[model samples]
Target chain A: MTERVRVKTMMPPGHVRTPAYLRGKVGVIERELGGFSNPEQLAYGLPAEERPLYRVRFTMEEVWGAAAETPTDTVDAEIFGHWLERL
Target chain B: MPHDHPSHSHEGMSPSGHPYRADNDTALTYWQRMEIAVRELLVEKGAVTPEEVARQIDTMDARSPANGAAVVARAWVDPDFKARLLQDASAASREMGFDIGPLRLIAVENTESVHNLIVCTLCSCYPRNLLGLPPDWYKTRAYRSRAVIEPRAVLREFGVELPDHVQVRVHDSTADMRYVVLPARPAGTEGLDEAELAALVTRDSMIGTGLPRTP
Candidate 1:
């Protein structure tokens, strides 16, 4: 089964890899892109922990709703593990 | 006594036909001053030599859309290479002798029914190792915000009007990965070799903002 996930809507003020537009949006894992250092920690010059990253695919309807240019079109983004919650 | 230093002129375009960068004679911006200070500090601390910095700049300057064009052209002619390119773009680029240096690349294919567009909504992260620097428009607020939201309209602005039957996929470089679109080869070019095909591949086509030239 394809892994389904929801992006956390946390709006913490810092250097975050997750974009504001994707927060709270639900999407499916397109592919696992292996592990990468957490940018949030790296931005503060701290020792960053490695996190698994996945490419998440969201339909235009899910991302833009009624304002979608093409309701069935898709958007893909690389989101770290911590930001994604299994759904 | 009045001293006349050699007057540096900026009247015409350079030999490359592009206007010379005005930063040399212009007042140093705050960021430029900061860069100078940081470079001097780094040199003083024995972190890096001026020659190393110059060499790195030259390396970056040598990378351009032509590198990406060659990759696309080879993919168009060789099915095995195309498969490998789609599987792992970074390795495929290196196989073709382009030094991409730590850039994790993803090659998105454009088929008859699917089109791919790339954007960096958060910032201007691009496949710079393959396509040189992102165009000024790619970094603009309009392109970044609208590319994902209204990609069809954005494509139209770039002179690409896709039919409703074709699905559009927008790749936002929000993290570590970078994407390059492998545009479909135009029809009626069977006689053309790899070099001719490469000549027809434009930077925008690889970025998915525009289509490859029809010839």
Candidate 2:
């Protein structure tokens, strides 16, 4: 089964890679890119830990609802493992 | 001989025919001053030499959309290369002798039914190693916010009106990876050679904003 995940909805103010529009949205993992240094920690000049990154694909309807120009169309974003909650 | 006033050459255009910006003549901005200070500090600290900085700038200037166009043209002509590109874009580009450094690239194909668009919502994370610098419009807040929400409208603004059946997949370059769209080969160009095919590839075509020129 394809792994489903939801983007975390936390709105803390800081350097974050996850976009605000994707917060609270659900999507399936499109692919798993290898581990990369976490930018959130790097932004503060802190020692950053490596985090797994995954490209998550969400339907336009899921992201924008009725406002979506084409509901079946999709949006893909690279999200860090920390920001994703497996569903 | 010393001139009293500045000499006019090429009617204010560079040898490449592009208008030269009066960057040096203008008063240094805050950011420019900061850059100079930091560069001087780095040189003083022996972190890097001025020659090294100049060489790095030359390397960056040498990279342009033409490099990407060559890659796309090769992919269009060779199915094996195209498969490899779709599987591992960075490796494939390196095979073609492009110095992409450590850029993680993903080549998304534009087919009869699917089209791909790239945007960096957090910042302008682009395939700069392959395609040179990102355009000014790409960094605008308007393009960043609207790309994911209303991609079709944005495509229309770029003179691309897709049919209803075509799927628009917008890739938000939010994290480590960068994306480039592999535009479909135009019809009636089967007779063209690799260089000719490459000529048809435009910067916007690779960015998914426009289609390749028809031969």
Candidate 3:
């Protein structure tokens, strides 16, 4: 049960799972969805290195800033371990 | 020299809304035609059988929102079933004779305090086995772009207004896992039977776009 982490803003080319909006954003670990093959590597027909994936929860305010209508609104995204760093 | 091919004909709109002008003007783009050619070559090589392909298509076509409605109606009446559904959605759905196939299914409950919404930003990935094909808007760039960023406004557009105290949780089905929202049974419908309850469960409710019919 990992607590809090930040999505790393890795601007890699080609297929990537991490959405652009979540990059460099801080979020809480809602659930650990176990491990999955790194999609970034798999997209290139390379052997994938399985990494831990977590369902991270981010507040609407954190994501949308002042544009957020509801401050309590939350968003959850499944992010791989390689893209996350401990907050 | 130009020749008219008997097999090819100018046709109506394709499934993706592409116009088939004429045989010379292919219905599909060059890349799409190339993709089909490659697929046919693979099939010719016995990588995958045509029968298997047809069967898969049949499975997809057979699915509808009614399957999801049945599960939600049962959960509304049976607390034990609801517990099982929340605990292990895939196994519980299988128990009800619904084939979830290989994807992981997660049922999120919408209580008084929390609301659950689902989206697939990368693509229009959904629980097609239970909910049929996703609506066209779900695949549009507007939805995929704004869902995670402004869920409250999006829900409002769907006429789903929640109190400020209640938290809205937008679940992005980014990976292999799919999600379904187990909406709270509407009030004043306690006397209705299971079949009636099932009738109230709309396709949008399961997708968190709207709520079950109000009694």
Q: What are the runs in model 1 whose C-alpha is more than 4 Å off?
A: B1-30
Sort order, TM-score high to low? 1, 2, 3
**Candidate 2 regions off by >4 Å?**
B1-31
Candidate 1 chain B, poorest ten consecutive residues by summed lDDT: B1-10
Full ranking by lDDT = 1, 2, 3
Candidate 2 scores an fnat of 0.96
lDDT of each: 0.94, 0.94, 0.87
Model 1 / residue B3 / CA error / Å: 37
Q: Cα lDDT of model 3 overall?
A: 0.87
lDDT of 2: 0.94
Give the DockQ-based CAPRI class for model 2: high
Q: What is the TM-score of chain B in candidate 3?
A: 0.83
**Better-scoring candidate (TM-score), 1 or 3:** 1
Q: Candidates sorted by DockQ, descending order?
A: 1, 2, 3
Candidate 3 wrong stretches, greater than 4 Å: B1-26
lDDT of 2 at B21: 77
Choose the strongest candidate by DockQ.
1
Q: For model 2, what is the alpha-carbon lDDT of residue B171?
A: 96
TM-score on alpha carbons, each prediction:
0.90, 0.90, 0.87
Clashing pairs in 2: none
